[model samples]
Target: MSDSLSEAWDFLTQAAAEQDDGCRIPGRSWVPPILEDLVLAARNTSLSRYYPFTSHARLRFSTGPESWIGNGDDLAVGIALVPEGRYLVCTQASHDAPVFVRLETADADEAAAMAEHLVNAGS
Candidate 1:
């Protein structure tokens, strides 16, 4: 893994360790393999190459009363990256939720292109 990717993984593992409460917290094992592959795909994109912090992101684990769209009281794991601006890659930690990315004021077209690349790579 690249240095940035390794740093991201370290941050995630640290977060998991610190936030371990008795409940099911998502650690490295909880992350789906495809999500990591998607992250790798995102890192290799030209758009990511321009940003120094593309893969150097923070990982968060939330388990509270915060209302989620589809997840109710389930653990949430989110990877927040500041590429052009800020984008979040999130999924329910314990549930079979689909991993999705939310971009802020960054390049929407670039995000779309990256998603397309991920899909193509998967196929």
Candidate 2:
């Protein structure tokens, strides 16, 4: 970790320690498991529900390049942090052999790109 990152962590720790829980409550942080870059880059990612029962918001890392997991049953999305500072996040309607595309993409538009790469990579 860089000095900046460590400093940021320290600041967050201090703030969290001194903060008051007046209106909203905090939940456990979600950390991903270790995996190869390609494996993580190719996963079906999405904003995991923050708490136990809500879909009101999403985590940005979940929308960028990070590893996420799901049962391939519900609506989903995935993100892969690009080496060049860019990123890729994709979605699929189903988890069948070839995840059906509700959307399509190559690499430019990161807004709503689905898993079009899966056709060549899913094997």
Candidate 3:
């Protein structure tokens, strides 16, 4: 893992430890919602403003059409293996939640797993 990624992981881990409700770390800032664009992003989100997320595999971010958005649900956030790029570490928030913490890294599984444990432990 890169130094910056390691730094981010440390911060998130500590934050998760501190939270009593849950470790709701912010996800990568989302771009405008568009279908084709999101599809393309699934393939090449690295080329766009999401160059940072391309490193980690555990996290991913997909800005898409309205239909794809979930109204309210408990989406699982955990470790996952992905292609050799960044992934999104987000929550299933409501419509008005603005995206934040555009995390960029290469070690997704490690980061995501740590986050999951932290979140679960916090709650």
Candidate 4:
């Protein structure tokens, strides 16, 4: 992995480990392999030359009866890689939720095209 990607992974792993709620930490095993591959592929694209990429882990929290409410306690953990502010590969997991990786785009076709490009770029 590139230095930036490695650093981001390390930072997120450390942060997750420090969380009081162990269930909120997605853990390395929860991260899909495609995420790392996508980030590396993005580095080879022209977009990376103009805009820097960043990776982060997002923790959801709820304070009220509703899950969406603003709360200080963690509910789940999600991680994402933003490549040049254009493409996003992310996943979320919790003790009570299923883990699924997603590539965000305008539509399914767009997402498929981007995924193809990233895969080709890596090859």
Candidate 5:
């Protein structure tokens, strides 16, 4: 994992431990819903560590036609390999407005697993 990912993972795992429901990470000051969902899913699943990146690049996604506005940032993203499959989740939100997170999957199974998990975890 890159230092940013490791830092983010540590920050999130700690937040989950402290809040049960997550609070924003300090210093960074933004919590895109996809990251929030990941935090909650980690909390729900007892996620305790960070996974190394399979490869390196600036991980970004459009979220396509699903695009909408909200309260914080223009975009944010994260990646993970779950039992279901590899996933790239993205979000766009701003302050005092609605937020939306979109999940991109390497395959349909991952898509199904993530959709179910997001709902089940109440994200």
Candidate 6:
């Protein structure tokens, strides 16, 4: 790993570790896995070349006047792993493929579980 990449990895792992009671919290440091069979740029990249973070807080609200004043709570959550400096968490152009959205939660395990589910649900 290059010095910069290593540093980035350390920073990500450390950030994950520092969390105590939130979705960002992780039981163990995340080591980016190699998805060789997948058609993803992250698959070819090294772990050090990526930065890991939680994608939380997905919300939907009404734009109408009633909703503007008070609306129901419509939200969903998922977590993802993306390459360094990338915004996309994961994508599936294939039909019937499960889309991995960011986890909206305050629990670490829940976020991890969502991430795992995304990996298991392949295109």
> Which candidate leads the pack in TM-score?
6
Cα-based RMSD of the predictions, in order?
Answer: 14.4, 15.5, 16.8, 13.7, 13.6, 14.6
**Candidate 3 residue spans exceeding 4 A from truth:** 1-72, 76-84, 121-123
Question: Which of candidates 1 and 4 reaches a greater lDDT?
Answer: 1
Clashes found in each candidate (C-alpha, N, C closer than 3 A): 0, 5, 15, 0, 6, 5
Candidate 1's C-alpha runs over 4 A off are 1-56, 62-74, 77-79, 94-98, 106-123
lDDT of 6 by residue, 1-123 (tens): 232434444544454444322333353424233111111222133321233323332111111212223432111222333322122333434324666544444333443444445444531
lDDT of all predictions:
0.38, 0.29, 0.32, 0.36, 0.37, 0.32
Task: Output the worst ten-in-a-row residue range by lDDT, candidate 2.
Answer: 50-59
User: Tens digit of lDDT per residue, candidate 1, span 1-123?
Assistant: 233534544444444344333213345333222223334444454323221222234433222222244322332334454433344544443446666654332443444354444433531
Model 5 ranges off by over 4 Å? 1-3, 21-37, 40-123
TM-score of predicted structure 5: 0.25
Clashing pairs in 5: 70-94, 71-94, 71-95, 72-93, 72-94, 72-95
Winning model by lDDT: 1
**Which candidate, 1 or 3, has the higher TM-score?**
3
Candidate 3 worst ten-residue window by lDDT = 47-56
lDDT: the better of candidates 2 and 5: 5
Q: What is the lDDT of residue 82 in candidate 3?
A: 28
Task: Write the residue-wise lDDT of candidate 3 on 1-123 in tens digits.
Answer: 332433434443443234412322334323211222222322232212211121122333222211134422322332223233344444334435643332334443434444444344531
lDDT of 4 by residue, 65-89 (tens): 2233332233222224232223343
* Per-model TM against the reference: 0.23, 0.23, 0.27, 0.26, 0.25, 0.28
